[model samples]
Target: MCGIAGILRVHPLGSEVPPPDVAIPESWLDVLDESIKHRGPDGQGRFRDRATRPDGSVVDVAFVHRRLAIIDLACGQQPMVSERGPYPEKPRNGRVAVVFNGCIYNHRELRKELQSAGHKFVTDHSDTEVLIHGWREWGLEIHRHLDGMYAFSIWDHASAGIYSAVDLVGEKPLYTFSDWPRHTLCAFASTIPALARFQRAFGITPRADTHPMGFSDLLAYGFLSDDGSLGYTPIELVRRVSPRSPIGIFATRGSVRPEPCNPDPARLPAFSVRNSESPEAINAGNVEDILNRAVESRLRSDVPTGCFLSGGIDSSLMSILAKKLIGELQTFCVRMPRLEYDESPIAGLVAKHIGSVHQTLDCHGDPSGDVIQLIRQLGLPFGDSSLLPTHWVSRAARDAIGVAISGDGGDELFGGYERYRAAQLLQRFASFLRMVPSMTRYRRREKSRMTRIGRLVQAAKEGGYPALLMIFPPSELRQLASFPGRKPWEDDPRGDSVSQAMRFDILNYLPGDLLTKVDTASMAVALEVRAPFLATEIVRRSMMTPVSALMPHGERKGLLKAVARKYLPDEIVDRPKMGFSIPIGEWFRTDYGGMKQLLLDTLNSADPFPEDILGIRINRTFIARMVEDHMDRRRDHSQRLYMLLVLAIWSDWLRGLSGTIRN
Candidate 1:
């Protein structure tokens, strides 16, 4: 895994100089590279070159790569260049060059296939090389032949056009800044700040529209925008390369647009649709087969790897399956000091059964200071509190391994969440719930699961399932801060209610919230975490199972449990899903380990946020009241306060970056 950054087709669009020949100075890459060094600590490389197009406009392409050395230790250095792929018919502007992040699990197979096609490789086992050859052979079709988590850009000196793509699941992120004329791609990077720093280097004007999608979107859904982009105030422009965009033209641009290369996800694959006990039995073997291949492919890393065992079905299954395949494996879990949040005992039980090396890293210390640092690492502002523990466990694993296998996709891929069931339950009572919108207006209860579900049902009246997952309701968001409400979420119209909720999470929440948390936390310490359950085949097959079969008799992830029964005892498979979480809510009331104090320090810092950013003018009085209420043990405002704290610190961090850039 690595952090990749580059500037291409940087003409006179944002620069002061009138262009026919102006190009971004290579020094700009240094600033971009420095922002994400933690993503790749093994080594760093830089590639820069200029091509004068026939029209006399000079197109400059520069790529910077930071390597973590997982696949080809000696020769996997990038900004890797190939002499030339054999297929380009046009005048070659330069060699085929690439900067890649994430593993290519099927690189060997691809390499052998390419070699048989008479494509020669220079590196012994560099997965990066396969991409160069694959591009030569497949062109835009390259995404179909490979499987693994990746975000990559190919600077085709051959086509003088750039091709970039994020993996099907978006496990790796590529953000592009495109404000140049004719959709010219100017800057792209693994993070927003890198591209922002590059934009600043050119003296481009900044946007006053910091919360273009409005800050309430961040509060309600944790993101300011939808699938293709984040609500980033474009120093030039910032759009995350999701599976939505297709590869497009060049002005020094690399489109990390994921093509529809994977199996058609438009129609959920059909299942047997038989009576109970039939589809589950039929799919269990298929799931096991596809999942086994996924796990085994991930284990092919050159560096030592371990599993993040939470003792939940996802991790337990992942750990046990990995152990069964490899004979012995190292498994790690974070043991929270808080009993309710701890699952290390159950993890130990699974580890003992699997006969793997088990280690429990204590996650007891105050993260007051650590969290501030962690948020700064996020390319965009993310409100997930679990990122702290995820980072802690990743940091713990980093001491022992380069790659950590995780059970991240199971919940989203299979129907493992109560929310899916809640949506159905709420849908039945939607008419009843809407009648009491007046009561829900004053009912701000969020303590018990019942109350939380109540709030969810209440909120769903305004929007849909997306609203059910909202942190701040529209009225509350408006009352507490001046941030406006986002566009109402329209429910997916295609599938059954349960299936639609699952699909919503797979497409939205998994990528927007969970994966962002995992990618940011893991890569913050330069550790690579792979989720086998999200493999293309597994997603396609799991989505095929009817929600009824997947959750027989009202059990969440029931189909997954049946599969686990093949290897684990009822004790492990039947246990409750103890998510990786922290007691930050309780911590806020007690200011446990100075968390309350730390928040105050940031919030009270003289104008920490731009006067305009904190909801035009932050309702300081309302914020202070909530802090007082929570600290005094009156209400459980932990979730709202934590989200506020993250936004405040991240907003301040962005402000600092902007100040430095302008200066």
Candidate 2:
């Protein structure tokens, strides 16, 4: 894991302007480099290339890399350049340089292939070197061959162009800021904070206004999605490099736009299930083999590694496999004092069963402390409450190991969430519900506890499905926000209601919420977390497997349980799914009254809804009612109120940062 930032300048044709002495000021580079120091504290490297276009205009590119020496600690210094061919040490015309973040699990396999193809490597062993050689050998096709979580940029001096790609699963984040009007700069970074600092240092004011629709999307969905796509960060000026999309930019003698290097679907892995095969054929052995390979690949870290055991099936299975791979594995678990929120005892049981070294840290302290820090690190509003526990767990794990494997994508892959079962049940009754007349007229009066039938009826009446999971329902969001409601997923392709919900969760919720929570929390402490469940092969298998196998007879994660039966006790395999969650509702009522006060103060503040902050009027009465209901135990408005609190905290943080920038 590392931090990478780069700036590329594009010069238009017919402009006989002299090339600037320093396209990127050293001060700005220093600011960008220092801002993300937490991401990579081991070492730093910088690369610069200046090339003149055919029309006598010059384009400059600069890359800064912060390294966290996980693999090949000595030889993995980045901003790695390709010197195999006719590239000069300081190529006056062009050069090939790479700045990368995240691990390439298949680098060893790729290295052997490249070496066989006569690509000599100078470094004894470094994935960074593999990328440099791979780029030289395969060019943009390199991304297709990679089987890991990554976001990388490769600058080719010969073409005066830069090609960038994010991993297929978006496990690693990449943000880009393009200043096209000035035609002077295009910048990319691993975190938004680095970009914000770069903008401040370089005096490059963002031209775009706050995206109002994005704010509405955030308020409604607890995330910002533009035109149904869920990759948008809160900042309008910054756009994410969409997952699985390779983009290229060339500085031609004339005007130019970014070129999309769309991967050929044929070249990418496809998910398919052999319908003729019996469930017995997709047995424990086969599932175990896939999981073993996935775990084995992520175990390639050069640093001490551990597994985050949540006592859940997903994490327990991962722990069992990891213990097999690495004898005497270290396992970390967070123990909440609240019985409802704690899973440490179960985690202890799994750890004892596996006979691995286990450590459980109590989740203490005000969660708001972690929330504020998390929001600061995330540089955006993320309403996932699990972040509180995830942060504490990561921090605890980091004390023992630099790398930890998590079972993050298991729920999405194996239909572990209750929402999947609910969706399946809803689908089963959809026909019957369709036959009932006046079903739409049965309005749900209770906001907090809507029954399954009510939800089904409401969804049918709405002409669209509700989010399989939501912070706030659309109706409540409408009451809260000044803007009109819009169904972002209205045009999404229809399928099996359960499958549709699963796909939605995989594409949006998994990446936007779960992965973001893990990445930000783990990375905040410089702990590299790899999710074996999210491995390409495992993901493919899960996607291709018939939903029946995954959720047989209304059993959530049925296939996973079947696989777990071989390695775990029946009690462990058959245990009900208990999510890693905090008692936020309880906290709001008793333990953390200050949190409620903070929310009320932020909402009621004179400048609470600043034009640039939310860009809409917040219904104070509605918000007050939510607080009152939660505090008085009339309703469990924890999720909705938590979302609002996160937004308020994030808005206030951004305002403070802005004020500091002005000062």
CA lDDT for candidate 2:
0.73
Please give the distance, in angstroms, between residue 465's alpha carbon in candidate 2 and its true position after superposition: 4.6
Q: For residues 1-663, could you state the per-residue lDDT of candidate 1 as single tens digits?
A: 899987776343334433323455556777888976889999999887665454444567788999888998998999899876554563432378999999999898889999998787999999999998888887777887778889898887645557777776678877777655444446778877677666667665433344535445666666533444232332336666765443433653322222223232332343333233544332655767777899999888888999999999999899988987888799999998689989999999989888989999998645897778877776455777898899899988999999999999898877888777677866667777766644442334454665665676666666767777777777667776555666655545455678777777777788778888898888888999999987766766676666776787878988789888988899888887767778888776567778878888876777655654333666777888887876766666777888888877776766676663311
User: TM-score per candidate, in order?
Assistant: 0.90, 0.90
> Which digits, one per residue and each the tens of the lDDT, describe model 2 over residues 1-663?
999998887666665544443557778788788877888989999988787776666787889999888999888898998744423442322357899999999999999998987777888889988887787777768887888999999888777878888876678988877665664577888888777667666675432234555665566567544232124567645677766467776765554345466544442233333232644233344877888899999999889999999999999989999998889899999988689778899899999999989999988645767787778777777777888889888887888999998999988877787766556655666567546553322322223234445556545434344443656556666788756665434423335666667766776677777877888888888999999988877765666666776777767888778877877899888888878888777776665736666666666676655656455667878888878876776666777778877877776766665553311
Off by over 4 Å in 1: 10-22, 87-94, 179-185, 205-214, 229-236, 252-282, 364-366, 437-447, 612-615, 660-663
What lDDT score belongs to each candidate, Candidate 1 first? 0.73, 0.73
Question: How good is model 2 by TM-score?
Answer: 0.90
